[model samples]
Target: MVSKELVLKAEIRKENGKKHSARLRLQGKIPAVVYGHKQEPQSIVLDLHDFTEGLHHGHKLFDIEIGSNKEKLLVKEVQYDHLGKKIIHADLIRVDLSEKVEVSVPLVFKGTPAGASEGGILEEHLDSIEIECAVTEIPESIDVSVKGLKIDESLHVRDIALPAGVKLVTDPELLVIACSKPIEVAPVEEAAGAEEPTSPEVITERKPKEGEEEESEKKE
Candidate 1:
């Protein structure tokens, strides 16, 4: 579980469009908007550094303080530049603490697989799963143990143990992880021996013309 308190101080944004957003970035602020449920979209601007630090803390819910007003929101989506290093845009969803929200939770593997010790390969199929739970009850990640997994054995979404009040929204049959035996490759020597080269006697030799042969005899 990840629990942290983050406070973002922002002000209502009056301007819109690309030019206004560029100006806001130049002023060291990030443009953002809040909307969800029955609330109308509210445009605002927050300090770039503060907004980034809040995301770094791993708290899904945000406590946004806009002047004298406080809004509880969930980080719905975050867009970044082509390099994936800078934040370009963000969407915040207002949510009540008691309300259940559907969100994707990351999956984490715990313990080494038994098949690995037996020289079998392990494969992960899914990295995350969607689940619905109360905002406050949101889990940081779901854990699935891979210990004692034999070759051809798999763990599905339904096998994962989730926190109380959490209901999985993904298909139960979705594979999370599996183990398989290593593929065997035959030796090159055997493959080469299986192929036989063509015999020279089977090939037809071209015959020389009679005039060319007479010219060759005169030269001799």
Candidate 2:
């Protein structure tokens, strides 16, 4: 769940440009923008280390301290560098604690499926699911148990049991995972037997030449 105590301090981003952003990164800070709630987007800068640490700790909702005022916001999106290893920019959306919002949370599969004991292969199709819930009630991750899944059985988005205030936002018909029966291979002897029998070679007696046919008729 989003922690109300996780507050981030931000400052108005004055300089705006590629060079300015590069300079900010050099100082261990990144550019960010806050919008939503029908308000004008506000430019800001945040501490790279602190923001990354908060994200690593699963702090999605934050009370951003912008000078004398603080606003509750959700981490709507994050922009990463080309290498996808570093955070380049962030987009925060203002939200009310009591209002409902849609967010994607990680899916955690727990327990070994019963199908595994039956020589079934378990396959996962989704890594996360989208859900709707109050800002403060947003879950960090959703746990799905495959313990009861049997061979050839599957789990879909509709089978998920969400939290009290949470509601599904993804398609219910989407397959989340499945337990598949293993493929069976035929024995070498059986495979060979299944092949079609080759036809017997056809041989024709040599045709008699004109003189040989005449001699045969005379002999008859």
Best by lDDT: 2
**Global lDDT of each model?**
0.85, 0.90
- For 38-143, candidate 1 gives per-residue lDDT tens digits of 8899998878887887776667787999889898888888877689987867888898887989988888899988888778898889999999998888887788
- Best-matching candidate per TM-score: 2
Return the clash pairs for model 2, or none.
none
List the candidates' TM-scores in order. 0.77, 0.78
Residues 1-220 of candidate 2: C-alpha lDDT, one tens digit per residue: 4444478899999889999999999999999999998889999999999999888777889889999999898999999999998999999999987799999888889999998988999889998999999898887788899999999899999999898889899999999999999999976664444777799999989999999999999999
Q: Output the lDDT of residue 127, model 2.
A: 88
Instruction: Provide the clashing-pair count of each candidate structure.
Output: 0, 0
Model 1 misplaced stretches (Cα beyond 4 Å)? 22-28, 185-220
